[model samples]
Target chain A: MESSRYANPYQTGFLLGLLLVATIYVTGRGLGASGVFKSVVTTTVEAVAPEHAANQPFYQAVVSKHPGASPLKAWLVFEAIGLVIGAFISGLVSHRLTFKTECPPHVPTKVRWIAALFGGACFGIGAMLARGCTSGAALSGMAVLSVGGITTMIAIFGSAYLVAYPFRRLWIGGKQS
Target chain B: MMGPFVPDIITDQLNLIVGFLTGLGFGFLLEQAGFSSSRKLTGLFYGTDFTVLRVFFTAGITAVFGVIILTSLGLLDRNVIYVNPTFLYPAIVGGAIMGVGFVVGGFCPGTAFCGSAIGKIDAMFFVLGGLLGVFLFAEVFPSISDFYRSGAYGDLTLDQWLHINPGLIALGFTVIAVAAFIITARIEKSVNPDAPVYSFPTKSHAAFAVAAIALGVVVSVIPDRQTRLLERATSVAYQQQHPVERIDPQDLALRILDRDNDIQLIDVRPDAKPGDRLPDALTIAVEDMFGKGWEHELAATKKKIFYADDTKPAIEAATLARILGYRNIAVLDGGLSKFKAEVLEVPAPDHPLSFEEQMVYDFRLASAEKIKKLIAEGGKKVVKKRKIKKVQGGCGL
Candidate 1:
C-alpha cells in the first residue's frame, strides 16, 4: 500500500487553531478527551454496581452535576466518538491503518504494553486532578490565556524533558542497531 | 449578533453537534500533523523530532491572536467566554504526572484515541489503562477531594493576574512561540543530522512569522470596543459635539406623577444609596451600558432619562448609548441634585406674583408635596437588577 505523507505541521496547526477559535466562538468551550474516559468509567460503574455508585460521594457528585441524563450521554463522549471517526477516516486516506504494536527496536512488545498501560493510567489520574488533559486544560486553556492551563503546559513539557533521559531506552535503539 | 450563542440561539442538542464537528476537526488535524504516531510525539522530549512543539505552539498562538482580534472587533464577548479555572498546585502536580505519562505511555488522551482509531494495539491498551486509572481515582476520591479542590483561582486569565493588557501577553506569546520554533529547529538538526527537517525556515515561513508578529502588534495598539467607546464618550470634545438632550427636573417629576410610561428613568450612578434613587428607575452604570442586559431598554422607543448625582456621568452614559445606536436618550438637567431642589424642595413665593408666575409657583408647591409623597411611597418597591448570563463550559465529566 502506498502511504501518503502527513501534512505540514504549521499548516495543520493553523487549521487546528482556526477550529479552536470557531469552537470557542460558537460553543464557548474548547476540545477535550480524557473527560470522555471519565464519563465511560462513571457510566460503567453506575450500570454494573448501581447501589455502590449511588452510595459513593464521588459518583454522587458526578451524577448530581449532570442530572437527568446517562453519564454516557455527554458532550465530550460525543466529541470523542467523532474524534475516533475522524481519525479512522484520516488513517484510511493515508493508508496507515494497521493493527500493530509500535515500539523501539530493542524494546520488547510486552514491555511497551506495560509502559503504555502505566502511562495511560498516570494520564487518567493526572487529567482528573488537573481538571483537563493536554487538549482540554493545556491547549484550550492557553487559547483563553488561563493561568492554570499555561502552568500545566509548562509543567507537562518541562517534566517530560526531565524524565526523558531515564526513559530514553524505551524510545531509542542503541547505536549498534 | 455577538457569538457564544449557546442557550440563547444555539440549543443543547445543537451544541452537542457542534462539539462533535469540532472534535472531528481536532482529530483530523492531529492525524494530519502526524500526532497519531507515538514515536513522533515522544520525539519532542528526546529532541529527535519537534513536530509536537511546532504544531502545539502554532495552534496556541493562532487561537490566542484569533480570540484577541475577535474580542477587539466586538464579535465575541470576552466576559462570557470560558476560561479554564486555575488550581495552582493540582495543575502543576497533575501536569508533571501527565508529563511522565507522556514519556511512558507515548500518547496523551487525544492522541491515544487517534492511535486507537487507526488500529494501534498499544493505544487500545492505553485507553483501557486510562479507564482503570479513572476508576481508581474515583474509588480514592474521598480522601483526595480536598487536594483536588485546593488552590483554586476561578477563571483567572494571565493578563489579569499579571496586571497587563491581554494584547501585550498575546504579543509576548507570539514572540516566544516564534523563538521556540527557530531554536527547536536548530536543536532537531543537531540531535538528528540525518533526519529530514520539515520546519526549515522558508521565505513563506519567515513572511508568515512576520505577519503574525505584525498582527500581535496591531492587536496590542488597538483598544477593545468598550474602551474605545468609553474614551470617546468621556472626551470633552465628543461631549460638546454630541450633546445629549436635557430634561428639566420639574418635567421629569411631572412625568413620574402623571405615571407616564413613555419615559424610562435610567440611573447611571456607580454608587447609589438605597432608597435614594428615583421611582421606577433602572440602575445601569456607565460601564454596564454596553452589556446585553440593557439592549432592550436602550433600544426601546421610550425616552431614556439618564441621571446621576452630577450631570457628567448622565451625559456620558447618554452619549455612550447614542453612540451604541440607541435613540431617544436624554440626560437629566443638573442631575438628581437639581431635581431634589427644584421639585422636592420648592420655596414659597415672597412678593406679589405675576399671573403666570403665580400659576407656576402654585403648581411647583403642589407638585413638590405630591412628588415627596410619591418618592416615600415608591421607596418600598425594590428594583430587580438584571442578571448577566454566564456561558457554561469546561471538560464535562
Candidate 2:
C-alpha cells in the first residue's frame, strides 16, 4: 500500500524555525529531547536502585539540584509528553498510525530491530557524553551558534556519514521502506 | 509587562504552565511537520528526504533573528538568558553516538517520542534505548563526570566569542540558509530525479531574507539598554527631588554647643518657614544650592551642615555642591526633634551624676558655649568631629 506524502520539507522547516524562536523567546532556552531521556533514566534508576542513583555523581547532580521534585517534573519530560500526544494526534488524523517496522524489504525485521537497539544504545551514551541529544545540543546549540552544539552536530552527522556506507544494505536494499 | 514571561518576571507555577503550553505547541508542530516518522527523519542522511536539514536550519535561522529582534527591543535581556555552556568533549562524542542512534533507530530523542506516540514500535525501542543510554552514562558518570564537566565555558554566546555584531552574524546566516536551501533542493532533485519538485516562491525567499537582515541591521543600529534607560529616567528623578537627610538630634546639639565653628547649620527646605530653627543656622532655598549667585557663599563655608528632613534635599544639595567642587558637606545625625529631646527638653541635672557622666555634661556644656559664640559671630563655621579631653581623675581607684 502506498503511504501518503509528507509536507514540503522547506515550508515545514520555516514554520518550525518560527516555533523555535518562540520557544527560546518564552523559555530563554532551546528545545531539548535527550535531556528528558536522561531524566527518565535517572528516575527509573532512583526508583529501582536508590542507593546506586544516590551514590553516582551524575545522578546526584540532577537529583540534588532539585530538592523536592521528581526527575520527571522536568521541562523536557513535559515537552516529550506533549510531543507524544501531538504526534499521536497528528498520526491518527493523517492515517499514519501503524504498528510496524519500517526498514528495507530485504533487511530482515530482526536485523532492523538489532540495528535499532544498537543505534539507540550508541545514541544514549553519546547524548550523555555531549550533555544533550540532537534536539538539545545540535539544534538548540546552533540556534545560539554554540561551539559545543555545532561541534556535536558535525560529529553526529559526520560519524553517521562515515558509517552509512558500511550499513548501506540496511537502507538502500532491493526495496526501500 | 512583555512576554518571555517565564523565568524573568513569572517564576513560580506560571513557569511550568508556560513551559507546558510551549511544549504543546512544540509537539503539535513537530507532529504536523511529520517528524513522527523515523524514515522521514533519517531520510536526510540517506538522501531520500531533506526534511530534517530544512526544518533544523529554518528553525535555527528564525530563532537567531527572533532573539536579535527581541533583545534589541529591550523586551528580552540577553544577559539574563541561558545559552548552553560549551562542553567540548561530551558534545562531540555524545553527538556521534546520537548520530549512530539516529541511523540504527531512525530517531533522535524528540522524534522517537513522536514516533512512539504514532504507534511506531521501532520508535518505542528507540525511546527505551535512549533511556538505557542515559542510564549507562549515569552509571559511568562517576568514572567520567570530569569528562562530562570538561570544556567549562560559561553560557558563552557566539556573538561574544566571534566578536562580530549579532546583526552581521544573523545576516550571514540568512544568506547561508537560503543558499543551502537552494543547493539542497537541487541535490534532492539530482539524487531522486523521479521525486516531485516542490519549489518555494523566489519572491518570498527574497522577502524573508531581506526581512531577517533588516531586523539584524535595526538591532545593531540601536544604542544599548543602560544608556537608554538612564537618559530617559535621570531628569525625571531630578524633577521629583523632594527629600531630606535627617541628623541625630543629640549629635547636632552636641556639635552646635561645642562651638564647632567647623559646622554650619543650613535650613535648605523647599519652603523654609523660618521661625524656630537651630542657633546660627542659615536659611536658603533648594534652588540656591545650584545657583551661581550662592557659589561664592557656599564655597567660603567650610562644613556645610544641614539638619535635613528628607533625603531629596541632601541628594540634590550634595549633587549641586559636588558640581561646584565643595568637598566638606554633611547633614546632622538627627533633625530638630532629636535636638530638642537631647538638649532643650532635658530636665535639670538633679541627681548626683557619675564622674564620667559629669565630664560628658561638661564637654557638651563647653561645646554649647563655643557654638553660641560662633552663631553670634555670624553663621560661618567649619564642620569637624569633637574631641572630649580624657578625664584625669580615677574611676575604680
Candidate 3:
C-alpha cells in the first residue's frame, strides 16, 4: 500500500528544526528526547524497586531532584508525548499505522524483530553513556555548533557506514547471495 | 516582570509539571515522524533513510534563527537559555560509544519513550537498558569524577569563542542545513530510485509566521514598561531636596516685645482665613500647597516648612518638595501643638522609661558589643564540642 506515512527528508528536517526553535524560544532550552526516556526509566526503577533505585547514583540523582514528585515530571516527557501523538497521526494518515515486523527483504521476520530489540538496548545504553542521543547530540548540538555534538554526529554516522556492510545480511533481506 | 513566569510565580514542584508536559509534546512529535524504529533512525548510515538527519537539522536551525532574532529585537534574553559545553576527550569517547549503541539499540532515549507510549515492547526493554547504563555510570562516577570535572571552561557560547555575531552564526547554520538538505535529498533519491517520492507540509512553517508577529508586538511594547518604571524613579529624586521649617518658642515669646531675633514663622496650614494670621507667624495654609504658587515661593526661599495640625502637612510638604526637585526638605520633630505643650501646657520630663525597658536597653548595648567583636573578627563562630557527646545526642536530636 502506498503509505502517506513517509515524508520528504529535507522538508521534515526543516519542520523539526522549526519545532526545535519554538521549544527554545518559549522554554529557554533545546529539544531533548533521550532525557524523557531517562526520566521514565529512573521513575519506573524507583517505583518498582525503591531500595535499588536509591542505591544507584543515577536514580538517586533523579529522586533527590524530584523529592516530592515523580521523576517523570519533565519537559522531555511532555514533548515526547507530543512526538508520539504527532507521529501516530501522521502514520494513520499515511496508512502506515500497523503492527508488523519491518526488516530487510532477505532476513527472517523474527530475526529482524530480535535485532530491533537488541539494537534498542544498545541505543539506550549508549545514549546514557553519551548524556544524549541523536536528538540531543546531533540536532541540538549542531544547532549551537557544539564541538561534542558535531563529533558525536560524525562518529555515529561514520561508524554506521563503516559497519553497515557486516550488518548487511540483517537489512538486505532474502537468502544470502 | 518580563521573563520566567512559571518559576517566578509558583513553587519548584510546578516547574517539574511544566517540564513533563513540554516533554510529552516533544516525544509525541518525534514518534509521529517514525523515529521509534531503529531502521528509520539508522538509515542515515546506510543511505536509505535520512529522516533523522533531516528533522533534527531543520529543528536546530529553526531554533538558532529564532533565538538570534528574538535576542536582536530585545524580546528575549539569550543568556537565559542553556548552551552545552564542548568537552574534548569525554564527548569524543562517549559519542563513539553512543554511536555504536544507536546502531545496536535503534531507539535513542527519547524515541524509546515515544515507542513505549505506543505499546512498543522493545522500547520498554530499551528503557530498562538505559536505566542500567545510567546506574553503571553513577557507580563508576567517583573514578571518573575528575574526568567529568576536568573541563574547566564555564558555559561559553559559540559566538564568544568564534568571535562572530550570533546572528551571522545562525545564518551560517541555516546555509549548512539548506545545503545538507539538498545533498541528502539527492542521496535519498539515488538510494531508493524505485520508491515513490513523499512530501508533507511542515507544521513549523506556520508556527514561524506566528512567532514573527508575536515577537514584533513584544518588541514594540517593552519600551512602555521601561518608561513607566523610569518615571517612578525620577519623582522620588525630587523630594530629597526640601527641608521642613521649625517654629521657635523663644522667638514667639520675644515677638510680644518685638525683639530683633523674632522667628520668621511662616504658616503652612491650608484652612487659614485671609485675616486669620498668627500673631508671630505668616500663613501658607495646607490647601495652598499646590494652588497658591508654593513651587515658586519654595524655590525662591530656603526657609523650612512648619505646621501645627499633624504629620499630614509634613507629608504634603515632602510631596511638594519631591515634585519641585528640592534637595533640602526637612520636617519639624514635633508640630506646633507639641511646641505649645512643652513651652506653656506642661512641666513634664521629656521621656519616662520603665525598669524593664532600661534593663532591655542595657542588654541590647552588651549584645551590641559582642556583635561588634564578632564582626571585627570576621564572624567565624567555632563551636567546640566533644565528638562522642554529639554522637549520643544525634539519635534524639
The best candidate by DockQ is 1
How does each model score on lDDT? 0.86, 0.66, 0.54
Predicted structure 3: clash tally: 77
Candidate 3 structure lDDT:
0.54
Candidate rank order under lDDT? 1, 2, 3
Between prediction 2 and prediction 3, which has the larger DockQ?
A: 2
State how far residue B76 of model 2 sits from its true place (Å): 0.8
For model 1 chain B, give the 10-residue run with minimal summed lDDT.
Answer: B193-202
Give per-residue CA lDDT, model 2, range B305-394, as digits (tens): 765464445445554554345666666654554554565554558889999989887766666555445444543443222221111100
**lDDT, candidate 2, at B50:** 75
Output the TM-score of candidate 3. Answer: 0.60
Interface RMSD of every predicted model, in angstroms: 1.1, 11.9, 7.2
Error at A105, model 1, angstroms: 3.3
TM-score of each: 0.92, 0.69, 0.60
Pitting candidate 1 against candidate 3, the one with the higher lDDT is 1
Candidate 1 has a DockQ of: 0.77
Worst lDDT run of 10 residues, candidate 3 chain B, spans B388-397
